[model samples]
Structure formats: C-alpha cells, structure tokens
Target: MRSFCLLAFVVALLLPTQSFAANRDQHIIVVSVDGLAAYLLNDPKAPLPTIRKLAKAGSVAEGGMKVSNPSVTWPNHSSVITGVRPEKHGVLANGVLVRGAIDVPTVVDPKRDQQDLIRVKTIIDAAHEVGLATAEINWPCMRGSKSLDDSFPDVPEQVIHMTPRLRQELVIDGILADETQPSFAANSVVGKDLIWTEAACHLIRQRKPNLLFVHLLNCDATHHLLGAQTPAGYTANAYADSCVAKMVAATKEAGIFDKTTFIILADHGFTSTPKAICPNVLLRQNELLTVTAGKMSDAKIHVFPEGGIGLVYCTNPATAAADREKFRDLMKDKEGVAEVIFPDRFTELGIPHPREYNQSPDAVLVAKDGYAVAGTPIGEEFVVANTESKTALGSHGFISSLDKMNAPLVLSGNGVRTGETLKSVENIDVAPTIAKLLGIEFPSADGKALNAALSK
Candidate 1:
C-alpha cells in the first residue's frame, strides 16, 4: 500500500512537469519597434547592438512587410497582433466615428477596459483558449480586448490627447495591474520617464506572463515631430534602440530568454519630403466639387465627369472618359502628385475602390514620397491653402513609394530558424504564422502561413 501511494505521487509530479514544458514551447513574445526598418540591423552607421544580437541568435527577415491601405500606426499594428487587414479588422483608421460627430478615438481610448471593440481574435486570444496567459503593452486595438490575462494596453494619455504622463501613472495604480509602466521620452530632462526596458523587466519579473506584446512609440513621435533624417530623429531612434536592448537583457535575466521566442516588427517606415499636396485645392479651383452637404469628412478625389471613383471625394461616376483623362492630366501636371491611379488600378493595388459605399473614389492621387494629404475641410467648391509646416520634411502615405509598404519583421527564439532570411512575405502572413506556432486557428484571415520560418 505504501509503495503504490509513492508511485502515484511521482506520476502526478512528472505529468505536470511535462505539461508545463509543452506550454513553454507554445508561448511567444511579440515586440514592436514602431518604425523599425530591416536595414537598421544592416546599417553600419546605426548602432542597434541588441537587435543585431537577436538577429544573430535567431531567424531574421531581410525586409519587413505591411498591410494594404492607410499604412499608418493603428492599422498596421492591429494587423500585426490580429493578423487581419483594416477592412476585415474594422479598425479602418486611427480614429472611428464614435457618435454622429467625427469624434474618432485614437488607439489609446479612455474606455479600453470595455473589450467589445475588437472584431477578430488575436494571437493571445487563441493562446488563452488553450490555458495560456497573455499580456500586452501599448499594442493598439486593445480596447475592450479579452485576449490578455495581463495588459499595459495601448491607451492615450489623459490631460491632453498626446500627453500620457498622468495616464501612465494611473495605469500602474493597482497591485496586480501595477507591474510596470512604459518609459516615455520627455521634452525636458527633468521629467524623463523610464525606458521601455525597465517597464518590460518589471512585467517579466512580477507578472511573468506567457505571451507578451509591447510597442515602443518614441520613433513614431519623433517622425511626427521631426523629419526622419534630421539630427533629432536620429537621436530619437538611438534612444529607442537603447530601450530595446534593456528589454532583451531583462528577458535574459528572468531566465526565460532561451526558452522564449521574440518577434520584433514595425508598423511602417519613414521618408523625407519637401512639400505636401492637397488635391482638394484643384477640385475647388475648377468648381468640380458639388456641395449639397453640411460637411464632408470621408474625402475622396474624383477623376472627371466620373466613370468610377477616381479619388475619394470627387464622386462623379458618370463622367466620360475624356473628362477622366483631363483629371489624370491635371493630377500628373501637379508638382507634388506622385501617381494617379484609376479605379481599376486602385483595385489592383489591393484597395477596393469606393463604389456605392464610397468603395470607389473617382481617382486616387498618391502624394510624392515625404508628402501627406492635408486635413482640409470640404465645403462647396473650395481649396484650403496649405500653410507650409516647416517644409513637410518627413511624411508617409504614398503607394508609389516603398517607404509606405516596407516594414521589419524579426522572428527569433524557440521554434524559429536562426539566421534565416525570408526574402518575400506580406503583413497578412504574420497572423496565420503565429496561429500555427501556437496551435490556434484563424480561418477568416487572408494571410497564408509562413511555415518555412518555423521549426518542427
């Protein structure tokens, strides 16, 4: 009787040990560099020691990947986590119409704890179903998210929309939730927030979540404030690199470094521009805009008389081919206009042209690299002149330029092939690959599984 009882105890211990090891294999950590470029690792001029080490330690892609349209922060980051496009994910833009007013919310909504905003299942959600723990820091589309067992959340700062100092403190107010807070870059030296590394370390040591996601937004803020090439932008990137290194070291110290897999990715890259163009000015100048509306926020540019949606706002679908030619000629003639794509061409570019539901805009005008669309209000036939904002040195949102599409994706750690370069892949592929890695499923995702980068 004593021998049988001892045997049973030994079996119970062995069974749980095997199960815990298997769960460790299934866990992963995803980190976002915000605007990390694949070249950053290869660039001798830039010193990203930690990233270089991670690349050396595991598999790394030569170039990054991105989603279809509005290749901005919210859309791309959401895709990274959920593996769904903006069209499918329902996070069409950074801001969505909360009420009748165009009161769109940024990724950092004050009401993120609600959890109903998410339309798709994230990698974490899939993990949680199998009894895995999840955590996130500054990941977008996280409001009303149920995927996390613990999350720092991609919330906006209180006080001002961009001012996150107060909000950061508030997030860490509770015991279980107060593991770590993000280290934000400060305008002044006196008010410096700790780096992301410190916060990530705290989470690892305190909560020790299974799947962790983090975003470092200093690069995006730098790009918005200064052009990519400026001294300030360069400095900001270096600072971000330092923060990344700290997080990597912390993971190592936690003794989970070798057991963990790290995926370092970015939302989009940056480019410098000399000027910004607003095609709405031309439409208003030509009296091409017809106003029977109070205000037009979802603006599109139409080509001519209107065969299909040429641009977003100028919706003259019945326009003749000759007029379409004229609009194309006008867009081409513009100095800053990069390329003018007709509806058919737009569809080929992966964007469904706005039709009855504004699917087909008349003609889509791509701004030259380094230029962006001016956020001008539309009323009757009118052009809101663009005030030169410090020469518009750094900007994105162009299809013709590679900067808009190119982003970095680094896969490392367990179950990832070390030093492998996937020459070609898309942003949509990330979700499916993560699903397979964790033994989850997302049948609705259009992205195919990148099985080559994974290990058996």
Candidate 2:
C-alpha cells in the first residue's frame, strides 16, 4: 500500500499544471479593466458589484492603484506585467516612435509587432517556466511573445478594434462566428468586451490555464468618449462589472472556487482636457523641427505625443544635452505646457533613471490642467482647442500626483486578507504579487509583493 501511494505521488508531480491546479489552491486570474477609477467605483450609483464583492472578501487598496510614469494605458499595463518602468520594458509610449523608421503604427496598425519592444520577461514568462499553461486576452506586451498558450497575436493586428475591418478580424477568430451574435454588428465595443469575457470563461474551462491575464475594455473606451465618471462612463463601468462576474462564475462552475485568486485593476485614471498642445508644432516655430516639400524631415528633435504627455527625443548624439535643455526652455510656461521633465525631474517620477535605449526620449513635457499634448507634426497651430472623441471628454496620462489619477485595485481569493484596505500600491507591484501567489520566481521585477494583502 505504501509503494502504491508513493508511485501515485510521483505520477502526479509529472502531470501538466492543469491537473495540479485542480488539486492545489494556487490558480490566479488577473483582470485589468481599463479606465477604472477609484472615484467612479466608489460613487454610490456606479455598478461595482463584482469589485465591491471582491473588496469585501479580500483586500482593497483604499487610496487606489498608482500607475507608472505618464500613467498611460500601454506603459502602465506593461509595467504591471513586467514590474518595471518604461525605460526597462522599452514601451516608451502606446505608439512606438522610431526616429528614422518608415512606419509609425498605432495599436491597431497592421505592421505593429512587439518583438523589438518589450525588453523583459512578464508574469506569463515566469508562469510558463514553472510548466504551467498561461493565457492572455488582449494584453499588449505579450502579444508577439510565445508566452501564451492561448492568445491574440501580440501584434496590433489582433486588437479586436472597433473599425469595421478590424472587427472582421474578430469574426475570423471564431469568437464571433455566429453572425447572430451582437458583436457581429457594426461599432460594438460592448460586444467586443462580451466576447472577451466569453473567451476568458472558455479558456478557463477548456485549458484551465494556471495564470490567465485578461483585459476588459468598456470603461476606458466609454470614458474616452463620454468623459470620466459621467452617466455613460458609469454604464460602461457597470458593463465591465458584469463581465467580471461572468468570469468569476466560470471559476465557480469549474469547481475550483475555493482555489482561485482574482485581482481587478486598471492601467490609469482619466481627466478632462480643455486644450491640446503640439510641442512639435512649437519646435517647428523655433526652427528646431524642419519640414520640407510638405513632409516632416528627420529633424534632430522630435516629439512623441502620448495624449497627456509628450516625449521629446533628440537624435543628435553630440548635442543631446543641449537640445534637451532647449526643449525644456521652449516648453516652460508655454500656454498649455506644465512640467518640462528631464534629468532629475524625469527620474523623480520613478521612470527608468538611465534610459539605455538609443531612441529613449530626452525629456517629457507634461500638460497643464485643462490641456493635453498632441504629437502632430503638421498641426497648423502649436495649441489647438480641445474637441471630443467618441469615447470620453476625459483623458489619462496626466500628472500622477493628483488623487484623480488613482485607479482601483481589488484582490480576493485564497491566502488574501479579507475586507482589508491597503494605503498604497503602484502598478509595478502587480506582476510580483502575482508571481508570489503562483509560486513563480521573477527576480527582474522591481515592485514588491503586497504582503499586507496576503493573510498573516
């Protein structure tokens, strides 16, 4: 009888993670709902049943989750997964700017690939190393990497974007194969979110991946159109909450309710802007930017616009310092510009101190209240009056110091403290916390695990 028991134990250790995950109490699911703000979530009318329930069961960061430098979606999301700043991870902004490259791709650009970007390993890498099945649902950094067993190609091509053509790509993924599904309709951001929820539930049941990373849109998408915390934004938030509940129900139906750990977080918060500043336009006025034959020339100084902040890259190695100082001088007290970050101020924001990437921006230009920075090189004016997008009147990537910039974080499951409120935790801490819970080693992560969230 003893020999038979020993043989069974040895066999169990050799099986795939799914089998072990069933017996062990270490499954973790990370759900990143874009544009989730503490201010909105706490509002009495906001639909936060899933978030509130999770908070009630585990630890909730009362003040909120602080995003990485610039507080943009891609940068902060990458920071959470890699536990490092933009400098180390190489995601300088949502839109990659290579000074001399022929292509500049947006999130949905067909040519976009994360191979040259994403310098470090993510939580998915660590989990995969431990012989676990890992999955990602529209998280950017891992798009191109082979880290996910189930995935959307990390390329911008697989964004499940709102465009009619982009939406076509989703139908091809078979998630929306049923033309009868609401997602098959035109302009359905909500439908896309629903499909992602379905995918999460599907993957959870089918593969039962040890670590599942999910990203839900509605809130960010809606807030970008309606403005932060507005009725429309609230509706989006509520929709996201329902999706979260759906995923949770999937875990329960899978019969692993007692073993799974769930985390709900956002990349950053959103705020309204009165005007938009085009630093490149200003640079052109100062002759620092050169346009020839109706096209932008490869000027020594280039500004990369990232909604609320602009990164100024100086290509001339010899005069990099001088140009950086000049860019600072040009933006100082400028109508819509606030802080011209370089040198000490740059590192002070917890950005990578000595950015090793050749294309790293020489400085950052922060927008003032009621303003944002646009990267348009051909703008007729340096400062354009604000308009609206289909999403929200508010924007993120603003000053991180403001309380409004705070996003929410809720943790629940085995080993997590129940009904506790944490004072603080940054986006960088997320990956490490997941690694700790999953028993994976990730030494490159800069953020510490939230020990306070774990039960003593």
Candidate 3:
C-alpha cells in the first residue's frame, strides 16, 4: 500500500499544473486613452466612433470609473494594475518624489524604474509568475521591469529604453533608424501618437502577449494646450479613436480577436482652469522659503504643484505643525484657494502619511473650479491669470471625488457581459477583473473582481 501511494504522488507531480494552465488561451489588452473623460462620450461634438462602437458592443460604466486621489497619470495607472490606491501602491506622483535635505527643495524625479516607484506586485507580475507572456507600450513607471516579456517604456529617451528584443525588431522593420535613435519626435502630437500606435500594433501582431498595456498621449497633450470640450480636443479624441481601431485590426490580423478581451479606459478626466493659484508665493512671502541665484536655496516649506492640486511639504519636522497653521492663516481669504487638507485627513483621502512614505505631503491644497495650482515661488501676485504660453488651459490631479475627474470605462470581446451598462466602477477594480477573466489568482488586490461585467 505504501509503494502504491508513492507511485500515485509521483504521477501527480509529473502532470502539468492545472491552476496555472487553465486559461492559457485567454488574452487581455488594457488600453488607456489619456484625458478621456466620461462626459466626452455623451458630448455631441466629440468624435469617437471606435470608442462608441466598443461601448455599444459590450459593457459600459455609465457613471464612469473613480480614480485614486491626486488623479494624475502615473498614480492612477499604478492603481489600475495593482488594484490599490496611492496609499498602498506608494506612487505619489508621475515619478518618485525625492525628499531632499531640509535646505534643499523637494523634487519629482521621473527617471526611476518600476521597482523604485511601485511598492506592490502588479497584474503583470502575477501573470508572468504563472508562465504567461506580458507586454507594455508607452506605459509609465515601467522603465526596467523584468516581469514584462516585451516593454517599450515611456520615459525621456523612449527609443533607448525599449527592451533589447523590441529595439532590434523595430529597427529591422524600418520603424526606427537604430538603437541609438534619440527621439520619436514628429511634426504634431497626432503624428507622435501614430508612431506609438504603429509600435503597439507591431507588438500585438508579432508577440501576441497574453497580457498587454498600451497608453496613448495625444488627447492629454491637446487638452493641456487647448481647454477640454473644445474643437481641438475633439480632433485629438478622433485621432486617438483611429489609433484604437488600428490596434483592434492588429488583433484581428493575429487571429486572436475572437479570444481576446479589451479593456478601454482612461486614467482621469480634465478640467478647465482659467486662473492659476500660486500657493508657493504665499510660503515665500512668509519667509518660509528663500530663493537665491535664480533657484530655491533655503526653504522651510515648499508647495509642489500637480495641476489642480498642490502638495505642501514641510522641510523641518519640528516646525511642520506651526508651518501648516501659518499657511492656513495666510490663505484664509485667498481667491483661488478651495480647501487646505491637513495630515489628519490624509487617511480618509487615500493618501499616505509623511512618516510612512517620503512622497506623502504634509498637506494638500485643492483648487476651486476655474483655477489651477502653480509652483512659482517668487511671483508678485499669488493668483494670476493663465496665459497660453505660461500655463495649461486644462488640468487634472484634483481630488478623485470631483465629478469632473471621472474617467470613462468600456469592456468588450471574450468573457464580457454584452450590452450591459454599469452604474459606476473604480479604477482599482480593473486588475482583479482582468485576473478573473484570465483564470489567474490575484489574492493581494484591495478591490474585488468586477463579476457584474463578466459573462463567465
């Protein structure tokens, strides 16, 4: 009897693992259209035929997806893949916020790799662990991720940062001049988007990774240059739609369109702000900050602007309490100051405490509608009119609870509920939903799988 039991155990061990191989045939592609607000879908003037078709053919989040606090590109994108907010994922900005010495100004450095920015395991990591192929194109905070089988990261020198295989392939296909090619610069934003689209399509056709992520940036750039809901924004949306169509075509050409699922969504929405609120000027006037030689030399406090919000950092811990109170008093009756969020409310707002994460701010300043935050410390006036050459006409990075920051969501293709409209969803739920569709285990995710949108 002992010999028979030993033989059975050996047989079981020799067989393939059922759990990891269950959904080997499934493919999931997540595409993020930058600056695609939920309201744009209902706008009569917004040109989005491809996106509209996807909505009609599959499940739609009518109320849109609520993003994490500090609704910027990198943090929300991290939440989309990790199924957690900034408090858990630890990405406070578009990159790593380096807390320098008390005498130096805190800086947001974007040159860091994935391991430096993200604290939690991503969906790509889970998939790769189970022997599934994964790829990311123009995805931020993924500069040097070994989990991805193929990667074309979004950084300063994109062409140089691509994985060795991807760079070689692009060069062989005549898409790029060489491995040392400096930039992907094009005549217009639309032209630059086309290059990224072409690279993504090529990746899909050749690699056919089980999991893929693609980010398009034309709409976001256009919205910043011209206000949202304007004619220029509409044109940019139309260009993004065409890029989506090309990706869909690539899937079809690869013969995986029937077996593939596409999650088309945006990181956050845009808001128009005609005026700029310079909270750093207030700190400068109170002698909390000092500038010398055209640069900040000695600073007791600093305000880092993130579009519609400003992150207040106190350089000295001993004076943090007193400094917060003093700044609150300074901006008591300011024109564009909306609310001063102190450290006590950080937990409720899904932000980490400064003691826990270096990127966490001592306080957060919210801007009122029609106003955006600026980091100019030496401006004579605290609030100034936004000019086309100086400031962005449209911005995001506001509190996620604001209705104007709601992002659009659409799920289509295999394993999706057809023609269903969801009232609302959160961006953190995306990773778990993808895991469920792929028959993978993502037990550490904070958000639950969106079972309502899945057909099983």
Of 2 and 3, the candidate ranking higher by TM-score: 3
**Per-residue lDDT tens digits of candidate 1, residues 1-456?**
999999999988765332343354555677787765544555575666766777787776665665445566666776776676655554434534132212111122234432444457666676676666677766776754656665555655311222243245444642223323333322232122233445566676665667888788766666656655557766666776677676677777777776677777877776655544555456545654433353333322332111011134343345434455666776766666566776666545554444522323345666655455553334322222233522234554445137444777778777788768786677778877776676656566778877778885
How well is each residue in 223-278 modelled by candidate 3, as lDDT tens digits? 98897799999999999999999999999999999999999999999999888988
Candidate-wise lDDT, in order: 0.57, 0.74, 0.87
Those runs of model 1 whose alpha carbons end farther than 4 Å from true positions after fitting are 1-25, 97-118, 157-197, 287-311, 314-332, 342-346, 352-363, 377-392, 400-404
Highest lDDT against the true fold, candidate: 3
**Model 3 accuracy (lDDT, Cα):** 0.87
Q: Candidate 3, 204: how far from true, in Å?
A: 1.4
Better of 1 and 3 by lDDT: 3
What order do candidates take by lDDT, descending?
3, 2, 1
Please identify model 2 stretches exceeding 4 Å from their true place: 1-24, 101-115, 159-174, 178-187, 291-298, 353-355, 378-381, 388-392
Worst 10 residues of 2 by lDDT: 101-110
Per-residue lDDT, model 3, residue 275, is 89
Instruction: Please identify which of the two predictions, 1 or 2, would achieve the higher TM-score against the true structure.
Output: 2
What ranking emerges by TM-score with the best candidate at the front? 3, 2, 1
Q: Among these predicted structures, which one has the highest TM-score?
A: 3
